[model samples]
Structures are given as C-alpha cells and as structure tokens.
Target: MQLHHSIGGTGFPILCLHGHPGSGGCMSVFSEHLSQRFRTIAPDLRGYGKSRVSGTFEMSDHLLDLESLLDRLGIDRTLVLGWSLGGILAMELALRSPWRVTGLILVATAARPRGSHPPISWQDNLFTGLAGVVNWVKPGCRWNIDTLGRRSLFRYLLGRQSPEAYRYIAREATPAYLRTSPTATRALRQALRAGYDRLGELETLTCPALVLAGERDRHITAASSRETAGRLPNAEFYCYPDTAHLLPWEISDRIRADIDRWLDAHPEVLRP
Candidate 1:
C-alpha cells in the first residue's frame, strides 16, 4: 500500500514512525521540531490515519510498507525516529537494512515488551471512539466530553505521566486516534501482549542509536529500553523522570535538543 505521509524541512531525512493507535500526524510535533535541522518524513501506518486498511493485515506488512515507502521516496539512507510500536519498527529496520539507517532515536519502546501496560476500558474505548469521530468530522471543534474522554484515556494508559505533561500530551493524540481501524489496533495490541523480543539481535546494528524511555512509562518499561541500549554496540540511553509513554510531548524541548546533539555529533549524517 502507498502509505500517506507528512514531510517537512530539507536536509538529511529522518523517517518518523508513530506507534499503534496513532497516525503520522501524531508525530508531527517531533517531526516539525527536527525539520529545522533535518528533513522529517512522518508516515501513517497501514491501519492508522489516512492510510487505512480494511479487513486484516500482518505486522510484517507494516515493515514492508516502511521499506517500500523509503524506496518510493528515493531515500537510500536516513535517520529513524520511532515511538512505542514505531520504535520496534525502527529497531527492525536498522537490523534488516543496516546500511540504510544512519542513526536511530527510539522513544518509549522496548526490545522485549513486558506486556504489563494497562488496557483501555470498554467505557473509555467508547468515549475515545466517539471523540475520534467527532474530531475528524468537525475539525477544531472539541467538546467538553471530547477533552474529558481523551485525557482520561491518556491518563489511564500513562499512569506515570505527570499532570503537567498533559499540556502537550493530548494536543495531537486525540486526533491521531481519529478514524483508526479498530481491527488493526486490536491486532497490534495483541502482538505486543504476545511479546515481541529482539534483544539478541541488537548487537548487529552498526548505526549510532539513542534510546529514550520515561521513568514512569506504563506502556513500555524503562528497564527494557535501557537493556536494548546495552545490547546495542554503540547506543546511548536516557530515562526522563516524571515522564510516561508520551515522552516526546512530555519532554519535548529536552528530547529535541538531545536529538540535535546526537545528530550533530555525527556530521556525516547531519551535513546536508
């Protein structure tokens, strides 16, 4: 499938991948921030955002879509920034095509998921679904119930997230979940729950990588990300205190600066 994508700035490319229950637009903040220094390409996955897929699709299809998207865009080599499920894809991409990945920025993700994250309740799901539909049908029109539902769901999933963080967290997330395929979301959640392990394969990636995790992330544990960094030959890991699954939004400025430092450190990848 030709995945719908959002692009910004111009320089070395950075493919920004969003997580499950999310769209390319979900990563817009991160992409836009990095765009000033590097070209950022954010693509909505097959079952998310504008690239919706009906019926059923496998996780392998997601991987294939990324490779094909790169091919379509004529991106031979680039940096990759992934969040949650997107981070898993980033690791897989670096492992499968080492020559194509110059560096990796992994956030709120793990090599082997603990599957301890909480699930949204049926009530919350109903609220989210409705809010999503409303947000999509009428742009910039949000109701009190919509904000309540979105924030409630986010809080539940990100139990460790700080109250102050919500200022930036729910800004784009509410819309990303809009028009998402429930079937695809459920399948992806099941896969994560089933355990996707790739620790042993990390040593093979030669690209410079920066792994980040929130100290309080309920979704993917910080220990897992740290372990992933340990397994990689050349990788740096950072854990932000008072943070949760939405690390990008919670610690936007800090993370962006760190990303800039990491990229600039490797002039070969940063130079236009």
Candidate 2:
C-alpha cells in the first residue's frame, strides 16, 4: 500500500496518524504549525485516503506499514502523534518497536476498549444511525452552512473546521477503498469495535508519552485519558477545555506548544 503522506520541515521526524473516518489530510490543521519545528509526516493508513489494502486490516498491519515506511525513508527513530483510532495504533507501535518510536502523543483515545462507559442515549443512537444511512446512500453529500443548528453540532463534534475544510472533507477526504471495498469497510468497522487492551504492555514501553483529551468529548471521557496516562510509566496528561474529539483542529496552537515544550524537556528522545 502507498500511504498518502504530507512531509515538510527539517528536524527530528514526527509521524502523525489520524483518526477513523478521516485521512491524513485531516492533519492539515496542524501541518503548518508543527512543520515549523518538526519534520511531520502524516500518512493515510491502509484503506483510508489513497492507501491500498492488500489483505486483512489489523492494528498490527498498520504498525508494520509504519515501520517499513520509516525504514524506506531512512528514519531510524521518530516521535509519533496519533488521534482517536490512530492513538491506539501509536501505542501499539511504541510497544511493539520501542527503539523505532522515541516518543508518543495520544489524543482522544484510551489504552483499552472503553467498556464501563454508559450506553449512548437513544437520540444520539438515532442520529448516528441516520448519519450512517446518509453516508451509505449519498457519501458525496455536503452539509450546508445555512443550517446554523446543524453546523453548530458539526463544530461541536469536530472542532471549528472552516467551511472550505468541510467541503474538502465531503468531496475528497474519504478513501476510494472505503467507498468501494466492502471487505475493507467491514474490516475497519470490526477494528473500531475491537478496541485495545494494552495496559500491561504499556509498562514495557521506554518512550515518553503524552495523553491529551478534550473536556467535552463524550465518546472518550477525560477520565479515560487520565487512566491511560497513569498506566504508562513515563506519560503526561493534558485536557483541552470546551473542545470535543478533534483537539488538533480545535486547539492546534496549544497542542503544538505542549508538544514543543515536551520535546524541549526531553531532548534526548527527540534528538535532531
């Protein structure tokens, strides 16, 4: 698979992996800011964006792809920032290949499948089901800005994305594999449902980690991020107030600053 990637800047590499239902292009929100200090490489994982899926889709498959990509690019070690589903993958990568990953930044994710959280409200479930139907029938449909209420909900769920960003997302963000391949879609859905259970494995990780969560994120509560941070021997935690799942877009500057400070504090791990 040829991972679609955006690469820029001149420093120790920071590989960014985006969340589910999104491609690496979604990281455009952070690209310009983080690129000033780090060589950020954001790749659309297998079955997302322009990346291809040769066989099964698993967290391990994504990890192997990342490792191969780094080796192919002559990068020995890198800092990793992964959001949502990507965060889980980042943790797995760090645990599986500790030497290759020097540091980690996990956002809107948990160390394991969130089992104890309350079930979704009926209204939320209805909306999600409707959205899934809409996605299936009219995948290219775009949301209108005139609908202020709906727009507000979108902003609440996804952060403050510009109108143009929404348009790009509606038109170009979805991968061909996701739209066309049933097997890939099924595998992805299954993976999202499977979640992670690596609290025990996290102890073996020598790399420092940062766990970030949005205060208003209902999907993954702030407590989950806190617990995830606690499980890691060398992990720090931060919460973004008034934000939801999309912290990178909602507070890119803050996220970048936190990462900058963290890197400065651990220069040995983020060597140029």
Best by lDDT: 1
Residue-level lDDT of model 1, residues 118-189, one tens digit each, is 666787777656654554455334353336534556554553444334433345666566667987777787
Which residues of candidate 1, in runs, are more than 4 Å off?
118-153, 156-170
Query: What's model 1's overall lDDT?
Result: 0.78
Q: What shift in Å separates residue 149 of candidate 2 from its native position after superposition?
A: 4.6
lDDT of 2 at 30: 62
Q: For each candidate, what TM-score against the reference? A: 0.84, 0.79
Give candidate 2 misplaced runs (Cα > 4 Å). 115-184, 192-195
lDDT of 2 by residue, 125-173 (tens): 5554454345445542454433331323344455444444344444434
Candidates' lDDT values, in order?
0.78, 0.71
Span of ten consecutive residues with least summed lDDT in model 1 = 159-168
Clash pairs (backbone) in predicted model 2: none
Q: Who wins the TM-score comparison?
A: 1
